[model samples]
Target: MPHDAKAAKAGTRPGGRSARVRTDVVTATLAELTEKGYDQLTVEAICHRAGVHKATVYRRWGGVDGLIADALALSADQPWPIPDTGNVDEDIQLLAREVYTTFTDPDLRTTPTALIGAALRSDLGAAALSAFFTARHQQAAEVVTRAVERGQLPADVDPVELVRAATAPLYHRLFITGEPLDERAAHRAAAAALLAARAGLFDAPAP
Candidate 1:
C-alpha cells in the first residue's frame, strides 16, 4: 500500500525520490478528501496516510487548505507543452482534453466538489475558491491568447471569453445538472467554441 516504493528503488533517477514523496502526499490528501470531506480533512490525517512525518507535511504545504490546493493543482496536467497542431481547432481540442481528463478523475473530483461546497458555507473557503478560480482562468486565457497571436484565431478574439465559453458547459453538467462530463460533451464544447472563435464571435466589442 506504500506509494513511495519507486522512490526507494535503487538506481532510480535523480529527483525521483522527491517526486515520489510529493506524489504520495498528494495521493494521501486526495484519499482523505474522499473519505472525510474537506471539513474533516487535516494535515495530520494526510501525513499519517502518506507515512510521512507531520513536520514534512507542514513544512511542505504550510496548512491544510494549502496542501489541498497544491494537490488539486497537480491533478491537472501541466499547462506547458500545449500542442501546436497548426490549427486552432486542434489546439482547442487538446486543451479540452486536458481539462476533461483532469476533471473526470475520481480522486480529483472529490476535492473540487468538496471545496465548492465548503466555499458556499464559509467566507474563508469562498475567498480561497475565488483565488483558485482566478488562477485557473488566467492559465486558460493565456493558452487562448497564444492561439490568437499565432493567427489561428482572429486578432480581435477575447481569449478570456472564449475560455469561459469552452468551460461553462462542463461546469454546468458537473455542478448544476448532476451529469457526468463525458467525452462527447467535451468534444462538443471544444468544437463549438473553436468554431465560434474561427468565425470571430469572440471578437472584442467596439471601442
Candidate 2:
C-alpha cells in the first residue's frame, strides 16, 4: 500500500487514510506483540506486517514504545460496554466477571493479555497502561453512579474508586502474582468492593 504522505502527515483521527493506516499499524503491532512477545518485537517486522515503510512508522510513532503506547491509547478511546442490569450488585458482578472471562477465555485471551503484559515492560507503555485503565475506570464508574442515583450505593461514593476496587484484585492476580483466577474469585472481588462502598470506604472526601 502506498503511504499517503499528506494524510499520514496530517494526522487525522478516525475515518480517513490516516485512520486506515493507524488501524493497520496497530493491528499489526498487536499481532506481532502477541506472536513474538515484546522482547522480540521489531519495528521492521511491524512495518512489514503493516505494509508501510519504516520511516512512516518511526516518524509517526517514534519507535516500538510509541506504537505500544498509541495502540493502548486507541484501545482506550474505543467504546466499552458497561453493564446495566437494574441492580447494582449484579452490575458490579458482571463487570468483574467480564474481566475474568476476557483474560481467561482461550479464544479471547491471546491478544489482549499479550498487549497488556507488553505494556508493563517499558516506561512509555506503562504510562499508556495507566491512562488506559484510567479511561476504563472512569467509563465503568457509570455503573456506580447509576446505582447511587437509584439508592443502591452511598451518595458520596467515589464511582471510579468503587469500579477500580471491584476489578483490581483480578488484575493483581493475573499480572502481579500469576495466580489462577476463577468465577468464585470474580464474585468475591465484586462483593468485597460493593461491601466497602456501602460502608463508605470509597466515599469521596469532603472538600
Best by lDDT: 2
Which candidate's TM-score is highest?
2
Per-model root-mean-square deviation over C-alphas? 5.4, 4.0
Q: For each of the candidates, give the backbone clash count.
A: 0, 0
After superposition, the stretches of candidate 1 with alpha carbons farther than 4 Å from their true spots are: 1-28, 47-81, 105-121
Single out the weakest 10-residue window by summed lDDT for candidate 2.
5-14
Write down the TM-score of every candidate.
0.64, 0.92
lDDT to native, each model: 0.73, 0.94
Candidate 1 local lDDT, 1-207, one digit each (tens): 354665466425566667778888988887787789877988888898989999888888787776666664564445545656666677777777766776788765666676565444555545665666566666767777777788777889888777777777887887678888898898899889888877889888989
In candidate 2 the C-alpha lDDT for residue 185 amounts to 95
